[model samples]
Target: MERKQTAELTNLVMVYDDNGNVLVEEKVGSNYRGLIFPGGHVEPGEAFVDSAIREIQEETGLNIKNVKLCGVKNWVEFDGSRYIVFLYKTNKFSGELTSSDEGRVFWMPLEKLRKAENKLWHMDQMLELSCGNTYSELYFNRNDSAIKPILK
Candidate 1:
């Protein structure tokens, strides 16, 4: 079958706790099967920021607020279409985590997630970009086997 590629806009939130643990979800029934932060597409006419909050609430049942826009990640899929994801992070939120149709949700230590087996696609790079209290954009070229930065 031919791979279908298209331009897409998405969001990914990195929710953290007072103890420094981060919430991650294990995605199911897709090519991207692994631990990933909760996030989804921005509906047409919906604000990007609003989409982030709504996605977290729907996927994790957490009423998140006061989230800071960390950065943006841009990549070209193997089939050549571009995919861009706006990243947000927040330690300020409430409500118990709930399971969603997307996957199982839970908290995991940051270090543990850094381990080889648990790492999601481009996660380490995303975390590094979030280290500073500033906003920026990251560009990458991605395929089934690798995700490399587009430096230039």
Candidate 2:
């Protein structure tokens, strides 16, 4: 059997404050639009945590540190290649918040985000993973598109 290789790698980070607010991006791009965490694709040969820190800085103007790996989201593409997203969370960050071309960056209460209607597709599940409620998310694209969460 041929080995299934990962075709893409990405990262998502949930930056939170002590007052129960989490950093969010109101994405303006063509893909993954709506309210989401600050994150992006991992550059070639970059370390996973390094990629997360870099992406957060690029997207939200925050220099994050002490990032903790909370979970992951993965799926098989149509061509049988795999795509993966490493989910990370941290409260340690510095710098003034600013928005990039990707979206507007702001802090929102966790409960408010939970009830928000403008979240990206399957963002709740991703939130779950980032909040340490789950450890893995598997997207199945059979006849019906379904996301299954694997608890930690």
Candidate 3:
């Protein structure tokens, strides 16, 4: 028999422009290539909000002194390795936007990003759903290996 595991994930307060453009960091890692958000695994005894702020600072060099929970995303795999993403938003911040060891940073129009040929990971759907004012959580499963969502 095999045991199931649930991974605790944390995403940052992905600041967007007034027009709803999102900034994606170019992940710097052996496996994490191309553009990605500034995030990482949640540390033990760390609050989700604190983790998000820390990650954003580490990746973007921005001080998000204020933020709020926008939504949540949950994923359950056949193996039962669950993943949860905490959606946060921030309209105010300080510090200069500098690059970290993670990746080069740039802004991407959220709508344009949605229409990109190279699809983003699962978060794209969650982001799309969260963009609405009437959403709080989104649940779904992965379709094959692609980023497509099989809503639950």
A best-first ranking of the candidates according to their TM-score comes to 2, 1, 3
TM-score of 2: 0.91
The C-alpha stretches of model 1 lying farther than 4 A from their native spots are: 1-6, 78-80, 132-135, 142-152
Which of 1 and 2 is the better model by TM-score? 2
How many Å off is the CA of 95 in candidate 1? 1.0
Residues 62-128, candidate 3: write the lDDT tens digits.
8886778877777677676777878787767678888876678777888776676544355566566
Q: What CA root-mean-square deviation does each model show from the true structure?
A: 4.8, 1.7, 3.9
| Rank by lDDT (best first) | 2, 1, 3
Q: What does candidate 3 score on TM?
A: 0.74
| Cα TM-score of candidate 1 | 0.82
Residues 31-67 of candidate 2 have per-residue lDDT tens digits of: 5568988899989999999999999999988999999
Q: Per-candidate TM vs. native?
A: 0.82, 0.91, 0.74
lDDT over C-alpha atoms for residue 36 of model 1: 82
The candidate with the higher TM-score, 2 or 3, is: 2
Model 2: worst 10 consecutive residues (lDDT sum): 134-143
lDDT of each: 0.83, 0.86, 0.69
